[model samples]
Target: MLKTRVIPCLLLRGESLIKTIKFDKYGYIGDPINTVRIFNELEVDELVFLDITATRENRPPNLDILREIADECFMPLAYGGGVKSVEDVRNILSIGLEKVVINSHAITNPNFITEIADTFGSQSIIASIDIKKNFWGKYEVLGVSGTKKTKLNYVEWAQELERLGAGELLITSMDREGTWKGYDVDLVRKITDSVSLPVIANGGAGNLQHIEEVVKQGNASAVALGSMVVYQGQDLGVLVNFPDRQKLSNIFG
Candidate 1:
């Protein structure tokens, strides 16, 4: 991998792939297995699959579907959604996923992070933090797929997760998700500066410059691509693709 990781973060609705705008509206992308095959061919660094409906609908990790995905995925894979217990994390890793992203349960019971981290190891747990600007433009931490307000400051929460033994943080901007504007560098910077763990910046990214800005300015350790990798363009049709290898190497090298 390059010094900085550029990962495609795909969303899931049942077994089909979808892309969301601000965690509210969504558009169908394609089959999950088929999309993974394309990324494998592209030789991307990594892939992240988050089931958007899992937590909202009150379910567990769709192991059968995820099993298929893990079997087909050639690159290192991580998954989130409906992971509520240490067993959930255990089963997910048993099936071949590299890490588990915990959100709702992490808030309802902060000790869950420690439990999973202790049981499996901190490197197996990823704390998924969804952040959005309220009407007053104040950043609020969200849980349950960005539905419930946790009323916790993201930087403080990130530090807490780091203390609780989370290996990394997947910090996504709900306000910028699927907008193709760019990442919330200010918000991300605060979290990165506050925590020692690596952070994967998500939501908003139109092109290579956007990616460069987040890593260079925001101090992000990695980036997660949503629309930039799944769409042909802003309003264009769906296309399973990644950036050119040479361009990515040049940007980070």
Candidate 2:
């Protein structure tokens, strides 16, 4: 097994899989089931399937589709996007997902985090904090898939979530997402410095060096890939792939 977790964070828009740029524009990738098969063959550490539109649409998770993916997926899977109540988390876990990531609902009802963490366990929960910088260059927390910006200081929020029983944090950078530039190391460092939860730095991973930088410089425990895994390269065609594990082990070790 790999010492450092390298997860593929796939975006779901309706029944299809897609990749987004800065959480705004998107390109069709392919069907989620097919994509999961590809990742399975690669023996990836884990996979994150986030329904980018589920929460914004005011609906519960699409259990039908999730069940399909769960049936086909061989590796540990995590899900985010329309998870709201403890019941939803229960249902999702029953489908074999290792963790349920919460965002908008956690802001609306922090108690929900406590309730689920108590009912399930902290290890089963991953509090997702979507962050973006404003025009004035201040980091801001986001809800509803990076559309609704909040005034909550991200570092404080991350610490609170860890205190509230979140075992890990999915720190997403809206500005660098899908740009293939790199992760927001500064943003990740602040949260890591403030909280002990394992930080999975998401968004804007162009190469393995970016992964090395985030884990070393940013103190991130894991790295999440978006554009780097789904496409052949920046602006290239869709090809579900993962970096060679030998190269990754060499870098992280």
Candidate 3:
């Protein structure tokens, strides 16, 4: 089996990096470039930078910022938010990003996934599914920064994305986002069982054991976290109070 990956998920509201709770209550964290530089020094395996407000605000991705990030980041980088076309994917890839994550665009035009995969290969594409549990206790797709709801069920959409040629699925629980309580394990398992592609579980990761639970119990191929690393402000140059990379690798091993 491939070794599970531990990734830091960064949210960009604009030039500033922010964190959100339950997909709401956005808090300014720091500059993206500074954070990326710190993570690079920490020898993180990968980084995901998402512009949380782009899609909600109906604006295109900030390529200039992305270019700046790409120039600084040594690890593989994945970018998403307000990406809607094959041209968008091409432009992002051209800027040295390893993967392009499509969320709202995939729902609006399902065929876009195949087009991207055909042009850039499936490995360059990541289908980001933002999910929220409704009052009835079923997970549903939340678009436009978790404000708009789509009728498509979470599992069904995930399976369809893989069939449409997404290389990976980034499953984030809006309900658990930034709560630090734990991951939505049941939700993670449901999505993982429904698709063969690697699933990166995001949202509500508070500690190292939470990471273990998500991987071993939730059955996720990888885990992503935010806030836990940035909240303490130990030092902008070093890793804060998150799991040690060597220990996490051992746990996954």
Please give each candidate's TM-score.
0.99, 0.99, 0.94
Candidate 1 lDDT for residue 148: 94
Model 3 lDDT, full chain set: 0.88
The parts of candidate 2 lying over 4 Å away from their true place are: none
lDDT of each: 0.93, 0.93, 0.88
> Candidate 1, overall lDDT?
0.93
Instruction: Show the colliding residue pairs in model 2.
Output: none
Q: In model 1, which regions exceed 4 Å deviation?
A: none
Between candidates 1 and 3, the TM-score winner: 1
List per-candidate RMSD values in Å.
0.7, 0.7, 2.5
Candidate 3, residues 1-253: lDDT per residue as tens digits? 2278888899999888988888888777878888888887787888899998998888999999999999999999999999988888889999999999899889989999999999999999989999998899878898888888899988999999999999999999998888888899999999998899999999988878888899999899998888677786322332433457677877887
Inter-residue clash pairs, candidate 3: none
- After TM-score superposition, the amount by which residue 110's alpha carbon in candidate 1 deviates from its true location, in angstroms, is 0.5
Clashing pairs in 1: none
